[model samples]
Target: MVLSLMNKDKFLHVVKVSMESSPYFQLVSSSDAYRAVPPGASAPVRIRFTPSKNRDYCHELVCLTARERIVVPIRAIGARAVLNFPAQLDFSKCPVKVSTQQTLLVRNVGARAARYQLRTQSPFSVVPATGALGAGDTVQVTVAFHPLASGAHCGSLAVCCSSGEERIHTKLQGEAVDVIVGLSTNSMEFDRTFTTMSSHRTLFIENKSNITAHFQWKAFAAEKEENEEKRRQCLLRPPKEVPQENFPEEKETEKVKGFCGDHSALLSSMDQEKMAKVKLMNQGAIDAPFTCLPSATNLGLLFKFAPEEGIIAAGGSQAVQISFRATVLGSFEEELQFSVAGSPRPAILTIKGSVTAPSLHFDLAELDFGDISFGFPYTQRCRLTSSSAVPLTFQLRMSDDGTQPAVDSVDQIRRDSDPAWSKGIHLHVEPREFTINPSGGTILPQGHQDIEVTLCSNTVMEFYRRLLVDLEGIGKGVAALIITARYQPLPGLPQALPCPGCAGCSCQGEVLLNALMLCQLDTRTAVLGQQPVVKSTFAPSPARSWALF
Candidate 1:
């Protein structure tokens, strides 16, 4: 038997010995595998003879061969590839490639390793890197591409594997970032020295950019100056064919001075939120919204003054005086945004100040009144009187000391009404004593004693006899006893003796010596030179005996 194998096909040989037939060996050749048929049709050899040589001997030999037809279904072995970036990458400068040696990570996700190569399309190239990756193994690779000049870039990395070719395509898109630079107009005058001034501005690269932007700050004395003819009109205005040219001789108005003029580095790394902190400072004396290197570009957003940014205490108000240098002279506008970071509302602050008003109010403070006393009534009067000014009517209310009463009375002491000359008058007096003695005495303008009240009483008596004198409105007053009290005792006994037995009498046991006598003093007396004398008389008590009486 002979057997051979082909590139993609298999061959087999078979030998069989049949026990029920004449013993014989047969051979078969495999050919035209696509067009072959079954082997069950060949008949077995049969031999018949007389039973003379031996007692009916029978034998069958069978040869068997089998070969499987090779029919394999090839399958690819990879998953979707991914790329991660820390920040937004500039597609114009990034590396990309297609299937040919694309130096990037490749991994096989199926049960086997993938033998593959890399290639690239336009604007991309693959480095000298190749890899055969297993199910989970990743390969590092390098790709180089002349990034897109502007706008979005797209391409694909084709992976040619042993099974077949699979495409892993990638697209990169980006936007152009303008390079920003800082500028300053150190000092500009509103008065015209030149008919027009032009600022030559330059730019610095930022955010990995190659873009350059040009700006011109043209100071026009008047609107008509923009069209005025000049000997250097060709330089001032670009040639029709060369509109991109820049003229530096147009006298750049110094530079727009910053808050801290020399330290422009403070503005270099500013973000959109931080650049907002820079503004048209000291605007009242200048044409502000100060022109920067990128003139029309809104690089300087309004400063956001948050309620929390300035020291707005729970009880105290906050005043933000964003100071700046006097960089130029003209009417201008300064704007700031007052906002809360996480809040949706925004406030605009447009303040006006001037260099002519440049006096530093270095300190601003407050007067705090904490925990004041309410027990005692107090009046603090500040009097600023202009002599020529008319006298204003003041209504006065009375207050209390710890021991006094609170009274509200209108005291209209005018310049013409009896008493006039005085200042803010606060009076504290004892409580009212109208029943015992009249209170609240007033003296005229000329220091003179006018009215005096006398109160007299015996040591044993609780009540006092009062005498009152009124000299309140008396001018050039003469001191006098305008009122007096005279004692005129009625006709009565001069004295009384103890009567111990009497229910309401004194403790002494002596009986009443004499009944109370009434003494009479007559005003119509006869004697010319004698003072009036009392005439004594006795009155008898009805309730007592003669001895006791």
Candidate 2:
């Protein structure tokens, strides 16, 4: 009976449907396109039970109903690809050779009832002598190929699965690369031997490539003439264009130059090999100076050059624009150089401009320390101006906060000069002095306690002082601590706090008191005392009885 059931088509339907939809079923028959299902397929599938051995009638019936299974023979095929190189293939060379390794995946691609083998055609080899594919199963094979020549290469990949194998040809592709060379030249000439505050100049970029081309700007460099020692430091020049503003017939300037050069170092330290070079392509061209000295006297263009955007292509050339406003009046020239592609050699350009003080304004017009804590650090700032035609210096002083005196210790105060804009003016601040603590706390036996607060300023100077007090341990029976400050003058001023009067002024007042501020010593006692007492007056009553006796 089981043998008869094994021959039926019930198992075939089960295998077909299960293999088609089950994620568990990857390997499939060649008729089953893994990419898509055939036009006439059922939504849900049925399973079949096939028993090869013989069984009793009742047993056979039970097996058919209870032991039935939907077998979807999963057969799937996949390939692995990799690139390998031969000993002779060098990336630096004109042509490159590469090898590819391929691995094939073969799985059971058939109905539960069917089983088969995988085979391939020409130019390919399968690993095992004879491969057996099981229902709902998979296997892999390896293959290798080499491309001998240059240029783009193309080919096909093929595979076979159960239920009649089919070929899946994926186009194989690769390429060999090469390099092309080109040339360019940059020469500098001065229109006037003497450079002034206002100087007009044009920077030229020429294409020396054999073919017409579009090129990306790489970078530019400039050098000062050997004799002009004072003029070596130059400013970075703005580009060729500027936005227009209100006011008719305004002579608009296209660029603004920035100062450039190691003004801090001596001339003997600067040699050709160690000279500064601007890289335009990889090395950034000077867009603007990050920092400058306040006393810079000469001005000039400080910038790098680069091939214009797009490709440097074969031949065409592009020029970068350079212009400037003379900030300092003087005679100066600086040598500049920029590099193109891979060549170590650089293009040389020169910038000439003058430097004078621009209209000066204070960056830190004024400063408000806001409010500060006692014993904590605080700072205020104010910018000074040198536009008065002469370098000036001003002193900084801390004003009184009100009730409290400003800390006097000015001996530790320090001043700093801006390397670029301080212009002989120094910024200084005195060390912070003064602190606040709980003055006193008191509690009465019957009601709430009241506290009085006092503050001490480290200095006798008449300045504002700010302080913070934290209180604790004050119970509901105690009122908050109240604070008020008063000023008192000193007989004499100390040498360190020489800036002011010997008197200190009042500042912020009124703050609450707390229980933590109260120091408690508990007074507890258990008393034991001796005393004499008479429970009954037996002596007088007994006296009468004794008299009778």
Candidate 3:
């Protein structure tokens, strides 16, 4: 509240300004006695009120002057429902994938009940969506923060009362770090001849701190379930004739299974030619039986590491060997997780590369249509080139598979079969509407072909679709084209006008059009000139003003 004082005389001297007698009100600004106020000038006093009960509060601002004494009254009513929360919840430096929780309290200080709903953004969630509190009742609400990626994440948690009378918000902040074990490289690549020869790469694991760190490492192949299913289906199909050059010699067939003498011997061998032959023989044997080896369990067969597990001294580093051999010709991606002994979070390193064969090649991994307006159609094109020496036949089909994993709700995520509520967004794809030109055809060696895909959406939402391309005959390779799109509503729709006979309403349509045009012109001018444009006003008719009853 502001208390204003006006001096009508030539000059007024303020002796003191005090609120010492009032317990509920206090002056927020420092007051100076003997301050001179010039004639015809005003002075303001700022005061704050702190109410302890839900009742009328009154206080007096007393001013003692050389000429006279002034007393000003101030009054306010305390609210019934008060939401008490901290200004911010700081979960100082947390490890990645770890969750931390904080509690907020809401109290009802009056004679009535209060109902409130809690809302927060991604990476932050409340336990209960809504709750009710009786008179003099208090409830606790839990706010959780779970970091999905390594970085600084922040958002807000808001509590809104049902009466729309009060809204309280608090900032949520957390930093995710994975600094215990530092890796030399997060990614590794293999040459095109991965199937015939084994490639070796070394990664240095260094302890970032001065403390002795005990670390454990493991390699996991991504999309194991999907890869298993694809492998099973491929094995069930008819076997194609193996090329003579690609086939293993009959003499060295028995040694394929145990070609790598022992883990230690294999790690010590420096003969690149012998190891290449061993890898080629093992891959040919696995392919001959129409069986694919799962990379997850076959890591031991493909790779040999010296000192697989150990402890690193303070600020020490160790070099670990990572060997790669591809049993099947395609793209392979794996994740290496390094975890400290006592830490709940692990640092992830990704390893990915393609083992190219004599087959078709696509330049892009996925297609993004960006944002499109509802009822509008969009078309995108991609090229497929034949990298083999022979002609390749391919078939194209659209898949109505499940939606991709959503990272938006990383904090409130639950299992699909969990009893908790689940929200899913699905995209409908019509085989007839999503057309591909020259759906199935053959391309000559070293030749290229263009494929066009047209998409349209009738709803304003995000969507995801997959286009599966299958190569015919010998290779029987499969490629997936992930398509994503977001549709939005058109802009610049007319707003609702006031009732014709209501107050501030004008019956003349020209007046309304002129007002809108003026507003648009002012906005455009302001944007172009980087300055405020003066606005013109239209006086309302006297009849319209009198229509308010």
Which prediction has the highest TM-score against the true structure? 3
Q: Which is superior by lDDT, 2 or 3?
A: 3
lDDT, model 2 = 0.29
lDDT by residue for model 1 (95-119), tens: 2121212244444555555666766
Error of 2 at 66 (Å): 99
lDDT (Cα atoms) of all candidates against the true structure: 0.29, 0.29, 0.54
User: Which candidate number maximizes lDDT?
Assistant: 3
What TM-score does candidate 2 get on C-alpha atoms? 0.15
Residue 249 CA error for candidate 2 (Å)? Answer: 52
Q: Encode model 3's per-residue lDDT on 1-549: one tens digit a residue.
A: 777777775544454787665678878776443455678888777888888876667777778875347787777855556666678899888766567788767677756667888899988888888988887888888888878678999998888877446788888999987658688988988666656687777889888754455566544334565544433443343423344456456633332221111111221111111121111111222222111123355433554434445443322234445555445555555554444333233323344545545556677888888875433357899988876655667888767632332221111122223222112232232213356777889888799889998764433346687887777644333677788886543234232334356654334444444444543221211211343321111113211000000
